[model samples]
Target: MASRTFSEEDLSCPVCCDIFNNPVLLDCTHSICESCLQKVWRTNRARQCPVCRKRNSRDKYPLNLVLKNLCETFQQEIGQRERYCGLHISEFKLFCKDDNQLACLMCQDTRLHKNHNFSPINVAALKLKEELKIKLQPLQKKLDTLKLKDPMMELPNI
Candidate 1:
């Protein structure tokens, strides 16, 4: 049997369209981000999932920090997981800056490009890593230099 693959679009929350943070697995086994649930509860009396239509109480939308952190870790290891895509259940991708969305490559070259800036998976990953290295290298070098310098000879903290 052929194995399945997941894209960034799969792991994002439907309401906010962000990677799952504080994921809450409902009684019906449908998961929703705590923040999205909060938004619903804020503007609603009976908060229900937009997907499963399952009823949820306002107090139940507490953030699940543990699950949130876990997803973050996993997302780094694997950019996207087997979560469902909110927009296109059949297709997925990291994110499209041009369209301000996460969608399959086929969605590109569409009228969404009129006022959008679409980018690819590798572009975002590489750009972010490069930017971080550029910013962090100098700071790390400074820290090492300070550690090597004598405390008495160093200037006082301003």
Candidate 2:
């Protein structure tokens, strides 16, 4: 089921629009953030929580593990999609052996790579990944050296 959430613009939730991290089930069964409940308690002396109509407890509320995991998974999927080729100006489908180019399904039938052997993008991507890994190694080593190097270098003037 899709999670119900308050609008971020509405200022109903500080962390997210819905699926509160530390959800406190009010007596009425409505859920709100534990922190939000505390804020409500500080402002109101009413015996019940405003949303759930439940009796207030002094102890801090426990975190909702299910909601936290859901949020994390959603965020990860979003991050993965943002890195996808569909969002890129260049579409990803066929790989040109000649130019090592990635093109959409349309580009393959066109004059762009008629003579070249076309391969699946995943295959080309594997080689490209190895190339990128090798290229990045030097930069990573330099970064590691910089991190370990002394801030102050002892030098005698030439």
lDDT of 1 by residue, 54-105 (tens): 8765466445565577667656645443433544443455566654556565
Question: Which ten-residue region of model 2 has the weakest summed lDDT?
Answer: 6-15
Residue 61 displacement in candidate 2 (angstroms): 4.5
> What are the candidates' C-alpha RMSDs?
10.9, 8.3
Model 2, 69-115: lDDT tens per residue? 55566656546554335533345677878887666676677775677
lDDT at position 119, candidate 2: 86
- Model 2's alpha-carbon lDDT is 0.62
Candidate number with greatest TM-score:
2
Inter-residue clash pairs, candidate 2: 27-54, 28-52
Candidate 1 stretches with Cα past 4 Å from truth are 1-5, 61-70, 78-158
